[model samples]
Target chain A: MESTRPKWPWIVASALILVWTIFPILWIVMLSFKRPGEVGNQKGFLPKHWTWDNYRTVFRTDLFTAALVNSIGISMIATFAGVVFATLVAYAIARLEFPGKKLILSFALAIAMFPVVSLVGPLFDLWRDLGLYDTWPGLIIPYISFALPLAIWTLSAFFREIPWEMEQAAQVDGATSWQAFRKVIVPLAAPGVFTAAILTFFFCWNDFVFGISLTSSDRARPVPAALAFFTGASQFEQPTTAICAAAVVVTVPVVVIVLAFQRRIVAGLTSGAVKG
Target chain B: MAAITMKNIVKRYGDGFPAVNDVSLDVRDGEFMILVGPSGCGKSTLLRMIVGLEDITSGEMLIGERIVNRIAPRERNLSMVFQNYALYPHLTVYENIAFPLRLAKRPDEEVRRRVTETAGLLELTEHLDRKPSNLSGGQRQRVAMGRAIVRQADAFLFDEPLSNLDAKLRGQMRTEISRLQRRLGVTTVYVTHDQTEAMTLGDRVAVLRKGVLQQVGSPRELYEQPVNLFVAGFIGSPSMNFLPASVDGTSLSTPLGRFEMPGEQAAAAVGDRGVVLVGVRPEHFEDASLVSEDKRARGSIVQVPVDVTEWLGNELYAYVPYEAPADLAAQLRELSRELDSDQLRTQAVVSLDASSLIAEGTEAALWIDTSRIHLFDPATGENLTRDEDHAARLTRAAEPSRAAQRSTQQPTEP
Candidate 1:
């Protein structure tokens, strides 16, 4: 354990990554509280005059507010549906004895491993054919389809580490497999399931290309597409602080959830490799 | 709470190779039976079958006269304690113990009462609110046991529940689980590879090897009169010493010396003198006068040159190279067992008081009582007098009385 200073190379590497990755986030946060005059052109490491106006201005925009509610609403719904469907599929694929179980799991993994860029055109065509384009369900259905596969793949790995004996113990104690899964396995796998939810939430929430391509109306558009609509042609007349403030809302929730679950998330991600 | 019987039980894995083959046993109401074997011998597989966690590939399993081959594990109402204790890490000790009762839809008051009572019994009352990860291995084992007894399950199945503990704690928990099993008396079936656990805790131990039942008997029965070569070698610590010997006329001769066989094997000898396996327990040797020319004496002794000694405080086990005949290695190998040192050098051990210790690399004959020598068939690996088939047939035809097994067909009182 003391010799875990084998961590030196990784510590240095992670420090470099932390500086690069967190720099923009820190910059955005710093800009969000800056006065309008410092919106884009302002220099200096710290804000000269910090105020709540950027936040207030972003909140006052109907476009930003609608999209905020839409993003939260869609992401939360997608997360819920993804967890339920994915957890069932994961437990089945991991624990149940069935024919072609491996193939079904491989298919889910293949979907995850497959590039999303390849599906954008095909999925867009299908959505247009189904007349779901420019709608909330339009956004939800495809996001769920994509999110479920990854969620199931990850959650199943978590479920596999749990001994089948615990379920057998529960079953012998009078729990049906479903009841055992819900009452016993789910609580045990909450940290893992939380990780899957967080990832799925961001998969849809931070999506700009798909969200913008899928919806064109305020009624069904999410915050990402709504924020994208503020740009004219190739650029926008909107103040940089307003965009920075929107970026804060878009990125902060995921960042905070990930930070809170950092330990669990690390364990969950590597859990697929081998048990520690 | 219930009697469990397995009639010709067989379990084959998905690949169709048998994990447990044609095993038959019975557990009387409230009896504690242990299924023991080396790893991959399928003792745990057998236990899982009894709990309905694994399907019986062949034969019938009855719990209280109900054939439960197709029944679910939960429906069998047997609680299992896993090797890792399998305690729910997210739940408190109290909750883990009460999990079964809660599943039964018992009132919170009832659940709380049972949990508290069980925790108090295990002396885990103070840890009731702590999670399994916070508890020590022994405490977690107690919690697993408490969960088993807290519910009125028809039976208890333990899959090496004490294996993960340290050696000292393993012994400690062995005593505790034994006491708890006796007190609860819920028809427990424990699986373990540790022979000491098999010997110390079980009412009757079922020994398995390569998916075959070797023997099932009390600890003393397995030690004093194992049915076959496998059981004899496996059941004892510092396992039995096997040396190649032949029946030369009325005497059993090896490089050590020719000694008289007990009367039972004497008749079986019948002048056939190829070679045979001679088993001598370490403790069977005594310090006799180096010269005992009267080989005709019914009770005989042998000389052993001391080699290396292991001092375990209370008793010392001395390994001796008795320099037996050249064929001893062949006999052990033929029997699918090995003790290579007995080749150009044969080995014997003497369990004695630590004070009377002999220094290593010395020539001294520790007399072996010839009457206690067990002669075995080399090719068949069976005790010559009793053999595998005869001991098993006798055990099968055995009545419930201890006398049935005491000196079975042997002309002796003890």
Candidate 2:
């Protein structure tokens, strides 16, 4: 069902995606299992012994403990809240006839288009002035702000494919509009929801640039901040093994989530895509 | 079971053009009604309106006598089967059928019984554990039907349910759906562009064109007495033959053949604007030899060149050359390619009664059942057979008056 193109340009492009996208992730994963002393000393494709001592050290640190909890809690909360809110807006935007929809969608696209990192200084200042700095709510608020637009766009495209008749059928079956949304549209929109959740989690989890700038305390830092803690240039050499161990801890849970849901996520993402 | 009513329903998209105009029809309780038209003719939109899928821009919708214009589809107590089936691709057939019930918190045992019964009816019992993607096209369609049937709604709305199937499968599913509807006896509204489905499945077919309702009647009523040219040409397979003709005393002067215009149609053709259109059915044209001996009894006979031929085992249709009058000839020439349509060009279809079939390119005398001829005002496109004097009086303004009118007529055999 697929054609094999022998053109050099496209073959090079495929190799580029494999190298830049896949190889770096695989290398990072391999580096995660290396010993604290041996890590960054030399690069290798595989680890010898693959000792768990670095993992134990990461677990023992207050920053690692707090950061892991904060990252998981904030990502889950944002993903859940973003998905719920986005599904509702998606249904209305796709199916119902309402004015200003075009303007609102354009506003969403603008939100996605605007550089998220540019807002960190203002957000940090705002949160501190509001007496909300170094808090879970402070981190979550920004996380949702960044993740919501994409969630809504993905879910809305999926929602548009659900025939209005299905909702009509639900309404005629003694279900209210809200009931139809909950029962029919929600289930039918699950693939989109899964994709949105995965994307939201990854976006929030992998955000080092904003995480570093927004929080300065152990109480509020996520894993990305904890990983950055070891990067000092003044010779108090950061334990590469402990950092790799933390990275492994942070990346594995999401990798599992994505692997479990790869089929649905891929299908939803590529539904109207052009294949190579 | 409940009868559905539309009181001048209209649907206007935000873009401002009305997708459905003020079209209204009575869908009888326990009857299978069909809304049919060409693409973009608003047939699907009309069905959606009754289901409350699309809001009524103006006018009222009543399910059995209760106005549902403001009611949500779920609250209206109807179930619809979409064209694509809309079966949850992830759920097994049993779960798909059980979905609405489960949402209502029906007991598991009751859900099981209903699902089993529906599965048995649709012949999907063996594949209850299979997901939709795992099922074949016909099986998926049945799963869709099974989902609709399990709900026990007051009416079932089907939106081109069989359009995805190939030709043979479409015919097979068409019969299966019609039978299923009859057995279930729930009021149903089926929409399709295929006239065969409309004529075969509907208790009364409502023909629509560009958002306007042309006519709604029993298949025979629409075929024999269509209200306008659109209905005349749209109601049948291969369609009715239409040619330009003029009123000349008791007869119509047509280039294809002269016709004895019925009195109701004659008066419509009289005086002032005299130009009109003539219509005759393909099957109604018999071999002149097949006609009864009397002149009036045998009716008007015309000569046509059998331009093409098709043989379908037991049934045969002939496409033949038809001459047009000067004005019509000019219109026919511009549209000649259409008149001698690629579908039935080089011929005017004449149905063979499994007898000696007509040969191609041969001249033959064809007789028309004069009683079955239809006329239309070329200017307004209204059917002349609908007595002008009785036009407004023939239709009723209320339920009781219509019911009284129905009670007075002889009951038709099912």
The best candidate by TM-score is 1
DockQ list for all candidates: 0.50, 0.30
Tens-digit per-residue lDDT, B93-201, candidate 2: 8988888888778999999999998999889889999978788888988988888889778999999999988999999999888777766678999999887898777
- As a whole number from 0 to 100, the lDDT of residue A253 in candidate 2 is 88
Q: With candidate 2 superimposed using the best TM-score fit, by how many Å does residue B344's alpha carbon deviate from the native?
A: 10
Question: How well is each residue in A70-187 modelled by candidate 2, as lDDT tens digits?
Answer: 8888788878887788878877899877889998788888999998778888988998999778887888887887788898899888887776656665565567678878777777
Compared with the real two-chain complex, what DockQ does model 2 have? 0.30
State TM-scores per candidate. 0.87, 0.82
Docking quality category of candidate 1 according to DockQ thresholds: medium
**How does chain B of model 2 score on TM-score?**
0.85
TM-scores, chain A, per candidate: 0.85, 0.86
lDDT of 1 by residue, A245-276 (tens): 88888887887888998987887787732211
Q: What TM-score does candidate 1 reach?
A: 0.87
